[model samples]
Structure formats: C-alpha cells, structure tokens
Target: MGVFLAIPVSTESFGQKSFTIDFEEGNSFTVDFETSFSEGGECCGPYTIVERFNIDNYSYELIEPSFLPIFSTVYISNPD
Candidate 1:
C-alpha cells in the first residue's frame, strides 16, 4: 500500500546517507540519515480504488545499514 524504511545507527556510525523514492504517480522525495524518515514517506492514494497503486521504485545510498519496509510505522500506529 505504501513504503517505509528505518536505519538504526549509533552516534559513531552516523553520517550523511541519502535516498530517493520516485512514485509512478509522482511526488518523488529524497531522504537522508540525519533527516531520515522522521519526516515521512508521503503516500499517494485514494485508498478505496477499484484496484491499487503502490510504490513504483526506490533506491537508497546507505553506509552499512539495517532494514526497510512497505509502509511506515506511523501508518500502523495511527489507524485513524
């Protein structure tokens, strides 16, 4: 439905890592380690569409990272 990613790092490993998510529907955005997804993974949806629209493609530049996801935790944490 959407996309989310988090990279855990210690102060020692912290650096200026970056990434970009390009949507087929368009609102492409870039994120970095300092700003991280602490901003957001903007979702493009009508949600009740006849079918579905999703992340077109994504790429990231990490300096030895951890994990990723198909929707942010905020989407999970706030069900309203």
Candidate 2:
C-alpha cells in the first residue's frame, strides 16, 4: 500500500529541513527529516538513507504509530 501525505512546502534550516502539514480537520503539525550521505558496504549497495520524523516533536502526536514506516526509519540503496 502507498501512503499519500499532504504537505505544502519545507523550510530550510542550518542542518535540517522541516515542513508543516495542515489537515482538513483543522489540525496540523510539522514533520522533519535530516539527510546525510555516507559510504556503505556493497552488499547493502553503496550508500544508505535513513528517514526520521517528529524532529519537531509533532509528527508522533498527530500520525498513527503503524502508518509511520514510510516517514520513519527507512533504509535505501540506489545504484546510479
């Protein structure tokens, strides 16, 4: 299953980026994900991507626990 999230845009900071999502029910919160690049083993590809939410301490308060995988801790391997 694919999860569709609605967020307008992101604001850049010194070492991080954050974006706010306003719900139709008049509830909204900001979600943040910090990106970094590093080398990894070939078995896991050449790099890794880890996605973390709630950097603003709001995502966990608004989103359900089970539906946070896509926005939470994720590992990615890309060969380009």
Q: Best candidate, lDDT-wise?
A: 2
lDDT string, candidate 2, 1-80, tens digits: 33466543222222354777565666555566554444556775433233444544232433333221233422222223
lDDT of 1 by residue, 1-80 (tens): 65555644343333354556555655565544331232224674221111111222334333323333212322222234
- How many clashes (backbone atoms < 3 Å, residues ≥3 apart in a chain or on different chains) does model 1 have? 0
Cα displacement (angstroms), candidate 1, residue 35, comes to 11
Residue-level error in angstroms, candidate 2, position 5: 3.4
What TM-score, to 2 decimals, does candidate 2 have?
0.43
- Quality of model 2 by C-alpha lDDT: 0.42
Cα displacement (angstroms), candidate 1, residue 69, comes to 11
Off by over 4 Å in 2: 1-15, 55-80
